[model samples]
Target: MKLYTEEWMKILEHIENNDRDYKLFSINYDSNYWFHAKVKGDEVEISNAKFHENSCSIPNPRKISIKEFSLAFPLYKQYTSGVPGIRYKMQKRKIYNSSYIIALIHEIIDDYYFRFSNILNK
Candidate 1:
């Protein structure tokens, strides 16, 4: 079984207006930058996407999975309290289950960071 829980999978699968055939996730490095990640079988595809009200389109995604990639999360980043309000609003609108999916995303991010840190010997 995948590391993801059924509830997390439900949140991903519930994206009815995705406009694409796959599950898309947004990773915000901080307020200034973000990127899209979508499931592609065993590996994830990262890309720049143009987001719409309920959908997004990725014209050019990473076609090849990279053997090595590392980006340091900014050490001084601070979470703003306003973000939770925005997310809650989205959740209320049925945009997504931000609470569950955000936790899943955090778990995935934490796992990748540790793996990459070890690989990069940082």
Candidate 2:
């Protein structure tokens, strides 16, 4: 698998330092960022699958399979605060009991800092 770009890594660092509200997303065919975590109690969900950077089509989902979603618990614990405590009453995919979701806050934060840092340096 390709490594994350300097931009991507920078975004991750920002997310680690600051846990403020943020939204991060990429066009289809872009593999600069990814989140390999589980959803349902037993089901694993890998987001940011194959690069799909096309602006016309739907955003690509980077996906990966796992023997058990639970195996990624440590990653989740280190990354996220906790599963969204409140559940939506609308239609939602069934998630693993302990499946951890890595929110993309880090990516956005990193991107933000990278841009801001560049401006300051300039």
Candidate 3:
């Protein structure tokens, strides 16, 4: 999850700066919060994860219909610098209970999906 966040930050930075004309795609908290981009017909997966869909190619930038280029956002506060969400709190807690931590994770995951969707649409 931490790695996913780092990769996401990179993707977000790229998009925010309009550094690349490539379309950036990030699906958060779907068992895999991954990042990918396509620039000048070349496809690159920022996350070190296997492709989950049919369009997994490089150089050619596998064609992804608008519908296929979907993204999910977080429902709760993201792992922003201002405030670490419940997940971080749990991880830092020395005596956090498993049940409580799992519940917090679920909340965070839902939030992640919401946030991602909101940002992508905007």
Candidate 4:
């Protein structure tokens, strides 16, 4: 159930392989820090931005490995929960159902833990 584990990487890879477009955005309190991810077909891109409220800034996207994607989950959770004024959006409504990306991640994690427990029981 831990984040950023090998099994988590596998789940991310499986998601990336699926033919769909996904986007996730998380912003911290005051909007000083944020992370965004976009997945299309088999490619995934991630971007992080930090700036003062009065400043103009742009998020530079970069290709990221599945492992890096998995590692970012904890940081995203921390910022989204611990920081106030958090704003999050997952998946574009036009391209996919609202919150579908978040649900997909939970489903993958649940499936992974279930299989892992089965293995341990054997």
Top-TM-score structure, candidate number: 4
Clash counts per candidate, in order, are: 0, 19, 15, 0
Per-residue alpha-carbon lDDT of model 4 for 1-122, expressed as tens digits? 24455644555566566543333322322322233345644445544422223322234555544444444443344333445532232221122221223333534554654446546768
Give per-model TM-scores. 0.26, 0.22, 0.19, 0.33
lDDT of 2 by residue, 1-122 (tens): 33334433443454345533322232223333333332323223344323333222215432322322223322332333333432221113232322212234233433454446547767
Q: Residue 64 deviation, candidate 3, in Å? A: 2.1
Q: Any idea what lDDT model 3 has?
A: 0.31
Ranking by TM-score: 4, 1, 2, 3
Please give the TM-score that candidate 4 achieves against the real structure: 0.33
**Which regions of candidate 3 deviate over 4 angstroms?**
1-57, 70-122
Task: Give per-residue CA lDDT, model 3, range 5-121, as digits (tens).
Answer: 443344344434443222122223323222233333222222211344432234432332211111112312333222435445534543222222122233323356545765886
lDDT: worst 10-residue window of model 3: 64-73
Model 2 lDDT vs. the true structure?
0.33
Model 1 C-alpha lDDT per residue in residues 29-96, reported as the tens digit of each score: 33222345555553345455334343344456642121111111211011112334554454344533
Between candidates 2 and 4, name the one with more favorable lDDT: 4
After TM-score superposition, the amount by which residue 111's alpha carbon in candidate 1 deviates from its true location, in angstroms, is 21
Q: Is candidate 2 or candidate 4 better by TM-score?
A: 4
Angstrom error at residue 56, model 3: 8.8
* Candidate 4 Cα outliers beyond 4 Å, as residue runs: 1-3, 27-61, 82-122
